[model samples]
Target: MPYASLSEYNFFEGELKNLQPVYKVIPYDINSSLFTDYAIKKRFIWMPKDVQANYTTDREVPVFPIGTVLIKNFYYDNTIPNNTTYIIETRLMIKKADGWAFANYVWNDEQTEALLSTQRETIRMSWNQNGTAITTNYKTPSTIDCATCHTINNVYTPIGVKPQNLNKMYTYNDGTKNQLSKWIEEDYLDTKPTTINSTVDWADASQSLELRVRSYLDINCAHCHSTGTSCDYTPMELSFSQSTVPENLGICREPIDFVTGDQQYIVSGQDIQGSLMHFRMNTNIQSEMMPPVGRTIVHQEGVELIEEWINSVETTCP
Candidate 1:
């Protein structure tokens, strides 16, 4: 049955505005996450009692049982005079016998309730970040938009629930522990490998530039760029496992569809200016930006990270 209001599901305890997860609903975070115009995201997974998700390969999504719900809420903080927080939307992906179903709930201005909505909507808001006032027209994705990215080979699937992304340590309400281990303890996952090939946190400068860049693209672009997806016709395969190969990252590969400026290769080694990937990441233009729909503004830090990685590459594309 479709829910008219978000509170109908009883996913959160106490006030709905608090956004706390209920006992069976476990909170989790990915190592490298998709950027959505700087909106902070909170993710949770809930499964039926005694049902556990089966672990697939590190790179593949976990096989979740039916009655599993992936919940994500998007919000912003430090808005207005008193550092008020405003939640924009909450997206849910529920696993059913047929397939995964997408639901989007838009929060009301009062911050009390969120109602199920299918139509596309935009909220104009401003927030303080690092003492700077930033404003944006935050876009709440329509159901069609959700389907566009979540669909893979005609099947709707969850993207970030893979072992590689969820293998990191999380500070839970009770205590800090590895997410996979916590899941195992909670009986949310059947079992995980002793040594999981985990993805690096893209924002961590201590990690290698290449790993950070690969992690960034893996979360942000790999969904569409992988085989059987929207941008699969393109040479690049941005998934972390495949991005280790230069060819899969489009190194020296010519852009087939379009070019920005004098861009020669999808990724020109040591030449950030000539790299199509860099240009696309740096732009906000709908036609030029990579993963264009989810973000309205350029992710400055992400672009800088890509630029540094490109400059570090020793191989110069001919």
Candidate 2:
């Protein structure tokens, strides 16, 4: 069943129930098509080598034509230029439904290079129009959006993916525990290893969770947490740097987590979990998860770091 029984005894669907989404992304393996998901996985990514070819990664679901208004976020996934990862959270059933609907919504796919193509056309026209137009002024979607999204998130997420738990402290695959590195060294993965400093213009801000976390919260959490929006079940009403620790203050927010020891998915807060973070990450999908737009997965390592950072909240603003 989509949503059997929440702590509230029933799920609550949000106003996002009317939209549907399709995805295209860069992939990891050069041998498959990224957009090959004709069967429609609940949550999955496009193959790096070919969007037309269908390839499935571990824990990736195969479902498409997600008929609902989902919160879609995009990324480049330089790790495998072929397919980028889009963190699409779904708010459709967060307010109106009675039980589990989906883990919000998220996945990986490509964008037909249309943005890149459009930029090229714009540049060509500029050249013909002025021949002396600032050649550097012409920008690509990857640049305009990538720099903003990545930098907006503290530039930690290259293509919207920060090497969460990266052991080397600066590199994703360099960590002794990073098994993914060995694959890259062996050329088994299309993604190349990335060093912490490898990111462009990262660390411009102080190396505090405030800066890093604030940036991420802005891009990831602020959409619904903002005023006038009915995102979370109880309406956490949070914004980046709004307080020294918005996410920390967000602890025990309802429809996200309820330490009252009573399950009420319909009302705010459910289960006796610590907060939405604990609940969202602890459980799998189709249940108490977040982004309330995309899938449930929580970006594994990314959440782990944010959780670690959140647990050690400081009064200083980020």
Candidate 3:
């Protein structure tokens, strides 16, 4: 049975507002992350004592033991005069004997405690972003919505926590160390391979255009687009490993379904105007946006990145 309140788990120490993890609940972060209307996220993982997760593959999620809990908290920093912060939600995925289970906790206005809720909600919020006041109605997804993107081959699975995404260094209370190494140190993970095909930070412009775009799609679209998932029927495979093939990226391939206008190919090389992928990313229309549920507004920076990448493609479809 799920706990009625998040506080019942005792995952945090002292004041819950501070988000300090208790003893064995280890904090972590991924390299490339999905965008959720620019909400800041804090992630942590806790597992049963003496039981460590087994490594499957660099690109796949580790095999966690039963009773493991993956926690993620979403919030926004208000840039107003008071500089107040508002925590929106905390989502937990617990590994059970059967499979993984979802538990979403909606924070209260007092910022004191969050209660488990399966109901969908819209939170109208405003915040300052780079000197601009931005307002949005952030949608909190229900458990059903959570399963939509998380299910693979009819089984609920995690998107992040893969070795490729967690191979980078992170600063802990002790000092800075590689996250995978930190996991080993805490006895939360077993088996550290010599080589890891790591994922790069998508927002880092210093990386190659291909690397940045591939990393972005791997995190944002691959969860549903890869094999045995939601959009597997589509020809495009956006996972970093599969995306290496031009055909998988849909460079010159025709889209299975028409999206609108003269967008003929899923990704029309060197033609942003004729690319369906670019069209979907650049729009905020409910019926047209890619990843449909995550954001209400367009990811302008991500769109720009895709546009730049599309323009750099040298191949032309026959």
Q: Highest lDDT among the candidates is held by which one?
A: 3
lDDT of candidate 2 over 1-318, digit per residue (tens): 223212121122232221222232111211111111011112112222221211122211111112211122222221222232322221122111331122222221232111112111111111121222211122123223322322322221222122221112222223433423533443323342353221111123455555565545544554445443344344454443353444333543335444433433221222223345445544545445455433323444446545665557442321
Extract clashing residue pairs from model 1: none
Q: What is the lDDT of candidate 3?
A: 0.90
> How does candidate 1 fare on TM-score?
0.97
Q: What lDDT tens digits, residue by residue, belong to model 3 across residues 1-318?
A: 479999999999898988999999999999988999988899999998989999989999999999999999999897345568999999999999999999999999898999999988898878887677888999988999899999999999999889999999999999999999999999999988999998899999889889999999999999988999988998899998888898899899888865666888999888999999988888887888887887888888899999999989999898
Estimate the overall C-alpha local distance difference test score of candidate 1.
0.89
Query: What's the true lDDT of residue 165 in model 3?
Result: 94
Q: In model 1, which runs have C-alpha deviations exceeding 4 angstroms?
A: none
**CA error at residue 77 for candidate 3, angstroms:** 1.1
Worst ten in a row by lDDT for model 3: 76-85
Quote the positional error of residue 7 for candidate 3 in Å: 0.8
The residue-level lDDT of candidate 3 at 74 comes to: 92
CA-RMSD of model 3: 1.1
Candidate 1 per-residue lDDT, tens place, 118-190, comes to 9889999789978888888888899988888888898998889999999899999889999999999999999
